[model samples]
Structure formats: structure tokens, C-alpha cells
Target: MERKHFLKSLLVGAMSAPALLAACGKDDETVAPSTDSTSSGSCTVAPTETEGPFPTKVPASYVRSNIVDGKTGHPMTVKITIKNANNSCAVLSGALVDIWHCDAEGNYSEYGGTGMQATNYQSVHFLRGRQITDANGLVTFTSIFPGWYSGRATHIHVHIYSASGTSLKVTQIAFPEGTGSAVAAVNGYAKGMNGYTYNASDNVFSDGVTQELATVTGSTSAGFELAITLNVAV
Candidate 1:
């Protein structure tokens, strides 16, 4: 946001998360055009997400899991607003974001097959897709709470796209502790699931504090709001 578009890795395990992003190279932030119409200033107009060290192990085949990624799909109702740190108009309408995550039991659908135990088959492309922000730089979609799987912790992957159609696969987001419902269904239903802690130990969220990192919102009256800041390169 400082120069052209704001983007940077922002980390090292030895240092703090915010400090890391500060250390990483960041692009200048861009604003939305007045003629457009999505909502207000929110994510950039670039498509795709800023990819990162986040794993890219897509399976040969996968089933739709409990959650679907991106800004479209089954009506899950998610309002994604791309704005600057001040919550002003970051206005990047038409930007594409590539999002992906796990199901409640933490199993991935696409990367498995007959070779591995069916993690339940999917009816469609759940947890994978691209979201294009509206003219106002806001994009909303439907999706469910993603499940947790092995090795990796609970989190979401996102990549950014620039106006030039360049992809900045660098930024990512995560859910903070005391977030989401502490469900018994996942641990009980899945063989390997149980006692999934919401600590910062997980690889995806070890850094614990960055715009890419997620923090939980909402309350007993509503579901959780996994809020995060995505510095887009547009």
C-alpha cells in the first residue's frame, strides 16, 4: 500500500509475525475506480491470491469436503471487503482470489483416490475456486467452516492478482485462538480428529500476527467471523 500495491512475506520463525511482514518486501496499495460498483474500498482488483510457503499439494482427485474455498459456490454467505489498515477504501474491484482449505475433519478431497481411504467423496469442487470482487472491491460467497486435517494446522490459502494479470501467490490467512466453535462432531466423527487446539503452534499460523493471519469474530448470537487483512498487489 505504500508504493504501488502492498504485499510482503512479512516473516521469519525467529522474529515476530508483524515484524516479519515489515521485513518482507511489500508492494504499493491501489485504489478502486469510481465508475465501478461492488461496495467500497476492499481488496484490490487483481485476481488470484498472493501464494506463499503454503503447501500446494493438490491431489489427483478429491471430493467436496465440509467447506468450499473462494467467493462463490454453495450459499455459505461470506462478505469479503478489501480495505486498507484504516478500513478505508482499498478499492480493488475485479481482483481474483484463489482460496483453499480443509474440511471439519481436516481431510483434503482432491489429492486422494482409491489408493487412499476415501475421505468421503465430494459432489463438486469444494474448497477450491476463484473469487472476483465487485466494482466496489467487495466480494461475497457461500462456504462452511473448513475441517482440520493432519500435519498442517487450520488455515486458509490465498493468492493475489495484479491489474497486469500478474499473480502474487504470497499472502495467506489463518484463524486465531478461541475462534470458531469447539465442536465435538469432528473429533468424534473422524478417526484421527480430537483435541484440535487453537494455538499458534500450527505451521500456517505459528507467526500469529499478520494481515494474512485471521482473527475470530461473531458471538453466541452468530457464527464466527474469521477476519484478516490481505495486502493486495494491484
Candidate 2:
């Protein structure tokens, strides 16, 4: 369904989802440190990742902070801080950050592909958006918890651009196994826990998800907060 129709169909459901979250008292928890231990100096830059099969250029109108205006699924806040890997990881302000992910049903918005089961959503643009980094080199988006699809673990695509709108780096982020499993159990997730894939088994993260896995806090009932720092040669 296109975004307009998609939102219309779910308007009532969207209005009530927040109340469910509040009733459950799901609050933010601090993200665990990466499993792979490394000092700041020893850590290499965040791995360069594939844009996957559904990459799209977010239109200016879609370049807003909240990407989940009328979308379903548990709420999540994703914050990315851009940094210069060569400059003692100094924050890089003014970078353009674009992010996209699938809805709770494992269907993406704005791009159509064989990987995505919903062909009707080819032209639909829902969970797709971008934002500019602030003085703290941070860009945040309000999105819903993403659903799982075959052949891949739960993940989100990210693209970084210079303040001039020039591309700087492209990569992706994944949720911890515990969080993925927890979120899958929520009301709207169709895939359920059985549909989840751990970082070791996922085709993209199997090589290693040490840096790609985001630190997630919060719960299924209330929502989740995800934070990941992107190290680039900005």
C-alpha cells in the first residue's frame, strides 16, 4: 500500500498503539557495550556495509527527523553520531544522515524488489527518511521497531553525507539478539520469535557484527531506543 493509504488504514491502530506502550511501562534501558572489547584507539572504523537490495534517495520532503509518523510497530529512537576516525574520533557536525528500514511486516517503503514480499509498496514511501547532524554530530530519527525477513537478520540501512550533500559513507546497523527476539513478540510483529536470525547466522553480519550491532534499551511494550556511533573519515 502507498503511504497515504497505508496511513489511512492504520490511523485508528496508530492512535492506540501508544496507549499500549504506556500501559506496559516499557522504559529505556542503557545499551550494552559491544561484545568485542577494544579500546577507543585500537578500534578500527565502523565496517563499510552494503546498502542492501533496496536503496533509495530520500526526497527532501522525506528528510525529516521522525520517520514513523503513522507507521505501526513499537516506537524506537535511533541516534547516530558521525565522527572522524583519524581525528581521535572527534565529532563531525553537519553531516547528512539517511536511514531506511522495513515496517513490522518485513516490507520496506519507497523501493520494490524481489526480496521485499510487498510489491504493492514499490512506490510507497513510509519508513524512509533523513536528517542533518547537529552541533553534537548527532542525527536522530523516530522509527518503529523493524521486522525480519528471510536471509537477513533485523537491520537498518544508513548513509552518511557531507554537509554539502556529498556522500561520505554507506553502512548498516543491527539489533542485539535479545532485543530482536523481544521486539518480535510484540502485538504487530508478524514474524514472531521464530523468524529471528542471530548475528552469527545472518548473511550480512556473519562475518562479524561487533561494530554494526546497535546498543538497544527499552522494551517491547513501551518501545526501544537505539544508539550507534559511526566512525568515518569525515
Candidate 3:
């Protein structure tokens, strides 16, 4: 789908332009996950992004590491570390991290048959899961490399909460430079990189992606690994 058509569909779906922009994520990029921070040990708080339009309505029901429930694409291992910005970037154990994203065809599960997404995946949950941080403040999810949509870039939505269930931060992960190639290599999906939007033009990532950028490695044949550390003010 072209960008304009997607935007028109969103408008017809009762989502305004500003709301749609606020609800999108970023494009692809590559880097190595940092140990202490997004870059160096700066401990900058990851920016708060939107969680709307298509969030997991029942995250507690899907507390598993493998979220790829029958979806096809390059295998992706998503490793996210949560850090406490108030405590010198210490690993925040026991935080709740929930993530959801579109499948290889740029369509999200639990949401379809609408103007925003014509695919009917509303009855199934494919790429959505939740996990609690371990002692190392890390949560790993086995998923597929997400495809891009017309108005937004290739990205993932993340919602973090405390062990007690208090919402901490809501954000998205951005990919690096090699994402375009990865998308093109995927088997399913007719779009490929034709209408894919880059981070520079992505409404959710145009300003900057310093904190949201993730380190992506591996090949389309072997799959990919993504690692990102999110700093939250606790």
C-alpha cells in the first residue's frame, strides 16, 4: 500500500493525522546493543512513544518469550534491558515488558478488517507477548523481523511497567541502516521495500532516534538478533 492510501484509510478509520503520527514507530537501523546505555553510559531516558491503536488488550495472558505464533519471516531475537535512570543506570529487575508489532506483511495481530488494516487477524494473536525482567533486568522475546507499513517505519512497540504493575514507560524500538536489505530478503509480503518508510521520514522517529535505536545483527537466511537497553526513571 502507498503512504497516501494508508493515511487516507487511517483518516477514514476515525484516526486523525496527529493521532496516527503519534501512534507510529521508527524505521530500520543497525548497531550493537550497549551494556550501560543506548550510547555510552549516558543513561538518558528513552523517549515516551504512543501505545495506541493496536496494543495487547490482555498482556498478562501472553507472558511468554516466544511471540512468533505461526508468523513467517526472518527469525528475530529481541533482547531488551531495563535500567533505572535514577540509580546510575542499574539493572531494574522484575519490571514488566510487553511488546507488539506487525508481521512480515505490515499487519498487526488482534487488529484487522478495519480501514487501517484490511487483513483479518482480529481473532488471532501472533506477534504479541509479555515478559518480566530477570535479575539482569533483561527480557528476551523470540519474534520475527517486523515489516514496514506505509505511514510508519519498521519498528516495535514496547510498554514497560513495574513489578507491581505500575506503568513505567511506553516506547518503540528503531532499526539501523541495514533494515532495508533485511526487509527485501523476507520471503512473504509483496511490498518488500517498495513503499517502506525510513526513520528520517517516519513521523515517530523524524526528530531523532538516539535512544530508541537498537543493535541489529545477523542475516536474512539465518535470521536476526536485536538488542536494546531502555533507561527509565524509577
For model 1 the local lDDT of residue 216 reads 50
| Residue-by-residue lDDT tens digits, candidate 1, 104-171 | 55544444443222454443355655566667666554455555544344556665454455654445
User: What 10-residue stretch in candidate 1 is worst by lDDT?
Assistant: 17-26
Measured with C-alpha atoms, the lDDT of residue 147 in candidate 2 is 80
lDDT of 3 by residue, 1-234 (tens): 111122333555576433464444433222223334434645577877767668898999999999999898889999999988777778999999999998988888998796667899989999999999999999999999997777677889999999999988878898885436554456235675665677887777888998898988888778899999888877
Q: TM-scores across all candidates?
A: 0.55, 0.76, 0.83
Itemize residue pairs with steric clashes in candidate 3: 28-175, 28-176, 29-175, 29-176, 29-177, 30-176, 30-177, 31-215
Best-fitting candidate, scored by TM-score: 3
Q: How far is candidate 2 from the true structure (C-alpha RMSD, Å)?
A: 12.2
> Model 2, which residues run further than 4 Å from truth?
1-39, 59-61, 113-116, 179-188
Residue 79 in candidate 1, Cα distance off native in Å: 3.4
Best candidate, lDDT: 3
- Candidate 2 per-residue C-alpha lDDT over 15-90 given as tens digits, one digit per residue, 9 for 90 to 100: 4422211111011112223221324334345666656456665455678988885878888999998876656666
lDDT of each: 0.44, 0.67, 0.78
